[model samples]
Target: MENNRAALILAADNSPLQVGPGPDQSSPAADEVVIKVAAVAINPSEWKMKEFSYIPLKYPHVLGSDVAGTVVKVGEEVKRFKAGDRVIGHCLGLVYGGAKHGGFQNFTTLREAVTAPIPDAASFQDAVVLPLGISTAAAGLFDDLKLQLPSANVNDDKPRDEAVLVWGAASSMGSIAVQLAVAAGYSVITTASAKNQDYARALTGGKHIAAFDYQSPSVVGDIVDHIRSAKGVKLVGAYDCVGFESSTRACAEVLHELNGGGVLPSVLVPPEASSLPAGIKAHIVNAAAPGMVAGSPGAAVWREYVPRALANGSLRMRPEPEIVGTGLDRIEEALNLHKAGVSAKKLVVLL
Candidate 1:
């Protein structure tokens, strides 16, 4: 049914996803563009929401975020896209609340602010990885951490005397954070497992000031000493992409020792308040918030920066895509695999 005009629907909390009728062909809002979704990328939130009903959601809803495909139609107020345009968008079914905006369906509506045209070099499968990963990264880097925004022109960068710490840089969201920070001309300090250390560094084109092995017991000391004694570059803040207690604690402690205190934006939940180091704090970031509002940092990145960066090859679809299967039924298998855990790659389902 995903091949036709059908949806992968969730009937109730903790229920299995069922292939069913797609959303009705309704008139899109002035800023919305409907797409024939060619590919959808899986995120941890999708599986978690279904298994635990973690987020407030209506039953019989569709859940997904990352989408890449051809624009089938656009509303009157949408000037950037026309039918047949190849594009990628962050679907907010989870946020806007319903099946219509969900990416798991064959066709879905996405806001123009969060949608960007894809270049010929970026395939549907490849570009699908960008929407949520890059959105979350932009949200954390710009809105949450209040760092300088990224420029579409990489050469326009004036290197800053600061570095950002991105824990778990090989994950979907963290990888983009590393690249976006470098794109904004800030040197990055990243940590990943040995298998992903090189991957994380390459995301920033080796612009990283230092990279660390998360498995090493000396990692905290290593990060501290490197940031402290470096000839230049101060630590502005840290981003905990892993969201585990250990990752958040490590980042909080590093910020406490180096910067006296700092804000940390996490992918999921932050550490308990009682466990945080003095003067250090962490907050969870929401990628959908920026897209919902016009002229936001997230909107600008999605509108101007994404298309340009993707066209010029400054942004590579990283952690890479691990194609799990094709079609609606295979989505469940993909979800299971994503739940099992992946490293240095994203799970994608082709429709």
Candidate 2:
């Protein structure tokens, strides 16, 4: 009977998540699979959505986006996965507006197109960090910025001359972005605090990555100088994972210096379009949007890259999971901790 379980439910805007009777476990649809969730990662978007109520949602909505679990059911049309497969999936709760699509519940329905098989070596806690972070990073780099798709094989040859700047290198998204860009054969220059420089470099897996201190007053100049010093490299642009106006403006300033006056920057949060500098194109990316669409670059991340990368060790389960507590009861505690802020790590709950 425990399979018929309770979920950490969000009753209203700014309300604390309360455990309540979860929706009746539903059968998977064509191209869908149902999972018995083993772990779920906490993301900042969950708290922001709970407070702002920006995305349209019904009362007592479920809030979570990253799920890692064992597949319990598969739609007849599903081909890549079967019942009992271990997987990591991106939940479509905010995009689809349904509790069935959310990850806070014990059982969740995932689109087969947006689910990836996990390697046996990875734990649910480790794999849970992949879904949302991978989605956010891949969306910015591949979808909005149009960087070349990464291969599962690492390029051991000389690093390519293309360079990408990832602002906030220690955040979950920033760490993954650095790995992804480096895997795609671009030299990655990223910003973290002084403490995380080594950690950021570790995420790049011995690839061409340079980590700098974002707190320094001359951070922008540091990036510009790095670009200038690298001979024959074109600034492919930057991904601003921090997404505040200050971070966005700093990214734009780095680009302005990189181009001697202008460049386009891809941002994770929606930006005030008017605030951008001349010739600076700001692409505000919604990482969740790709999972909702078929054949989208964001969808390909889960469908193709994540599974292969995980198996081949090209994609890492990173920033690493800092498990707050166990069980559905701890969801609220994890959410508060996430809202309070964490450094260079992801908050997670093992269900």
Candidate 3:
């Protein structure tokens, strides 16, 4: 066993994360793998949980989710992985409560089921940006909504033209949503700040996407007009990454108007219960639901789809991380930047 330092939150309702030394590292379980963490990314859940005290807090809890690292040790029964493998995965921090130090520490552990080999073409930083977004997007697009992918033939042509709208397209989650939707043979339309339109376009393969300022009054109208121009919207589906009232209402309105009958999947709290339009379903995506954790059926679905997509390059990693911090001391600052909203890139910390 080796001792390692980590950052922890000793109390709930605290804005700052406390950095301090904690327990020594122990050997991995027979089914688990020990990782020498190379980089970690911050997500909104980290701060939201802290601010709202969303999850029960055990004193000296570690907070983080996204991790990319090299395998240093593997349990006796582990077969699919070995030491020296580079990997990235979504940490089940929320499900495991806040006690685990997550990816913020120099060393961490996870079951092989929750992780996969990083694509050889992608860097540790780029790969770290994927697990959460890719998992959530894969779950929503393939598992929840049952969207279909194109066949092997290049000219098969099986409805790769249906329009799907992605609200908050510039967000890490939203960016993944747009890319996955397009890869699944659906045309994508998304909303974001005017400045991020180029970034969104690059991710979407330059498809028929429109970026509108979230602050604009005509945002909904602009989206509606785009959908209308795409011809009759029979198979309209929307993915809302921003859960704010305005974005949700606007997406709800556009989907309702365009499809006249379809479901919209949202990552945030569902749209106001009573205000939902007829023939429209609002499916809430709880990415961390226990069922999606390692060894669960939902995890099976993700493990199946994400690896194939990633390995074949159907999905591309996002831009290189813009900011990289070192150790727990830099975690609080990274969380603050994420809370204030990131631009077109992600911030990561090297553990």
Highest TM-score, which number? 1
Candidate 3 TM-score to native: 0.86
From the highest TM-score down, the ranking of the candidates is 1, 2, 3
Question: Over all chains combined, what TM-score does candidate 1 have?
Answer: 0.96
lDDT of 1: 0.84
Better of 1 and 2 by TM-score: 1
Candidate 2 Cα outliers beyond 4 Å, as residue runs: 1-3, 8-10, 260-271
lDDT of 1 by residue, 1-351 (tens): 233355455554566788878786457888889998899999999889888877777767888899999998899999999999999999988888377888887888898888999997788998898889878999899888888888768653457788899898888988888888888878788898998777877786676446899999999999999988877778887999889989999999899989888788999888787789888768898888667765569887887788888898888888788898889777888898999989899999999
Output the worst ten-in-a-row residue range by lDDT, candidate 3.
150-159
lDDT for each candidate structure: 0.84, 0.81, 0.71
lDDT tens readout by residue for model 3, 207-270? 5555667778888887777667766544457777777767777777887787775666777777
Give the per-residue lDDT of model 2 (tens digit) for 1-351: 135455555555487777877766566788888899999999888888888887778766787899999998888898898878999998887877487788998888887777899988899999898787777788888877888877778665777888998998888888888888887888988888999988888886656888889889998888898888888998887888887787888888887777744444454554666776666777667777567665568776667677788888878788889999899889888888998999989999998
Regarding TM-score, does 2 or 3 come out ahead? 2
- In angstroms, how far off is 205's CA in candidate 3? 2.4
Pairs that collide, model 3 = none
The true-versus-predicted C-alpha distance at residue 197 of model 2, in Å, is 0.3
Model 3 residue 125 CA deviation in Å: 1.8
